[model samples]
Target: MSNDGHPMKGHRFVAWLIAAGIIAASPALADTPTGAARELATKTCAVLAARVDEIPGSGPVFLRSYDSSFGQGPTAEPALANAAFTYDNALAAIALTACGHRAHAQRIGEALLSAVNLDRAGTKGRLRNTYRAGAQTQRPIPPMGWWDVVASRWFEDPYQVGTATGNVAWAALALLTLSEVTGKTRFRDGAAVLAEWTVQHTRDGQGPDGFTGGVHGYDDAPQVLTWKSTEHNTDLVAVFDWLDRAGAPGDWSHQAKAARAFLDAVWDEASGHFFVGTTPDGVTVNRAVSSLDVQLWPLLLHGALERWQRSLTYAEGAHAVDGGFDFNDDRDGLWVEGTAQAALAFRAVGRATDADRLLAEVAKELSPSGYIWATRQPSISTGLAIGPSSATDDFRYYRRPHLGATAWAAMAALSWNPFTGQRLQPVRVRTTGSK
Candidate 1:
């Protein structure tokens, strides 16, 4: 028997070991859609369609950024101006697709490709606040000598800032979605790189985890800027999940192992919670104690193990706290928007009753722009009003209403998730020859 004819048994043993590892690892969850879910999606899709840009090479979105005077003005809607970051575009892309606005999402993908062409803007793009005094903002993707700037970041560039994990992961997801839509290998390859980097860096800072912080294992060692991230750990897990499921080969096994390890370390089995950021001593509950009804990160990342968030933090004056669920941080209670997002997450894991109640609140007060933002509620904290690294604008962060979070909340409300709570399908409201 020739030795070269037979494959090594040791190699087969390694393959089995890897397979066992993946099987033992946690799996990312999926959601199905229904009536109200479809309606919310349908309305949101209509809004995106009305507002999207129909350009040639760059499928740029046409809208405006929020102005303080008008927290979300006509000009504040997404426009060509805010299309640079991969993360924003990624979430927007997936939400649009979920809402059935596939073309609009594709345009987002195209615009991302075109952004690579802008030679002047570097990692910061063409933002007014960035690049002081005539500095060229756009640099070639993977600027010649710099080490961490990968071809994907240079090419896709999810968020305007390099360190934003949400941008990196979400944008990568959007690209993966695009690859699914367009049947292209390029999108898949680029998305894989970004996803790998996200998982690697989130735990140990292997691939420039984007945020310029000394963020260590569950530690808030804010390195670059003091602007903290409550969602990076929870949200970036989404990247690991999508890439893992997508069969992204290179370094995926390692990335998955690292992410699993990091998540395991942060989960507090004792308190039945997950620490958003570690206190200096590691056991103190300085960061956050529990999950919010509105916060979907816990649900999305961990699939809501009954033991972790089976408990609820309820609002005052409620009747025995019937709708209690996931906790809200920053002292922000269960407002309509937060409730709606909570409903969305619940729907993801077969909690339809909760989803209906949450979506109902949004529908009752849904604004003309297809969203809900209450200005008078003193009990609740506005979600999106806090600017991205706009710590300098602390007054605005505290005083103004949550604008960005409102948009996201609205998006979640309108999404169609059959797996949410118990799959409350959208009521089919058709307008056929009705005046």
Candidate 2:
């Protein structure tokens, strides 16, 4: 049975193959650079398409974000067995779009639309960070959870049910991407709803002046997170700008400017890198840590590289681990998702060789199960907490086969920019030694 309790049919694989453009009549896979990239992209899309095929009768269906590792058999990792993270699903939607799988992309898009219209505990326009991973058969859609036989109660992870600014912006980006690809107004309109919720709830005017971290629980009155994130603001800069370009009303240009201003404020002139963001005070810069995505994602903004290219240097210096990239400055291990993100950022800046180097690292992470590993180590510390109740910095990525990492790898292989839906042109290949 699917996550929504619907029985699935096995005949969908052929249709999925046709949608993925992998019919038998297709040209033979080549050995050159472009051919190699296409091969990687085709394999990655096949992984995603197989996930989409697991659900039936869906206006909105979600694919689980992570699968158990190679030796874990067919059972999902218990912690995230039913969790379809909005951010991961959004990345999958954009990756499918980039790979020319419109029908599959539309299924995830419909799921995002369903989330936008059906928050079980909040106002209609907002989305939780995650939902149950399957077809939406229940009204107001269900958040992810499982029965705890030991505790004799249903257990829900608080972080999964909370709203995060970055996650919601990613959802909007996915919707807008679908709108651009399919020319559908409903997708665009759904993105507009997300934009409105973000502006109304998370907008902050404190020190740096951008969106906050969003709510942090599953209650009707969830705890409002006062912390501001450079990463979150970076996501909104792309989102608000896209909305403005789509002729979405309601001062979207000014909103974009506000988000951009926040990014500008967080730039550290001395280190030439962005600070992680503000503390809970929302007035003081949180210099306690560094994040890889915070440094690279902003570079994808239109014309941002021309102004903030130094951030790339900073990332190389601080986050590079072995041959790949890590999640934070400690550089303890390879973070496959961050490595893929760095590849796309490099490609965007005309560093095709640099992009290729990172993609090679990403390719090493491919698992026998067709999904990508989340990290090189058996477990890697992020130096962060998983939820408000966590006692310490207990958050970590294990050696799981991750859907999000695979989607990002596919994007990097296709040279597709998730934020803008435009392909980055590859220039002359120049080897830039070690990171």
lDDT of each: 0.41, 0.79
CA-only RMSD, every prediction: 18.2, 6.4
Deviation (Å) of 94 in candidate 2? 0.4
Lowest summed lDDT across 10 adjacent residues in model 1 is found at 126-135
User: Each model's TM-score, in the order given?
Assistant: 0.60, 0.89
Q: Write the per-residue lDDT of candidate 2 for residues 1-435, one digit (tens) a residue.
A: 112111132125434556765532222223115644665666677677667866876467888877743423233644587678889999999988877777888999998998898688657778888888888778788878888888899887778888999999999999999999899988988998999999999999878778998988768557888989899999999989898889877789888888888887898878889999888898899888889998888878764735467788999999999877889888888888999999988887878788888887776666656677788776777777776667998888777778899899888888888878766663222233110
Error of 1 at 288 (Å): 5.3
Tens digits of per-residue lDDT for model 1, 1-435? 012212253234324434644212211112424555444443434444434532333334423222223223233222212323344345556655555556766766554443333323332221111111111123332211112344433222212223445555555666677776567766666667665544444444333221222221111222222322335544545555556666677755455455444444555565544544433332333343333531344554424444434322222222012332212344433354445556666555566677676665444433433323332132433233123344441311221223233334435655433112112343222222110
Best by TM-score: 2
Q: After superposition, how far is residue 272 of candidate 2 from its true place, in Å?
A: 1.1
TM-score of 1: 0.60
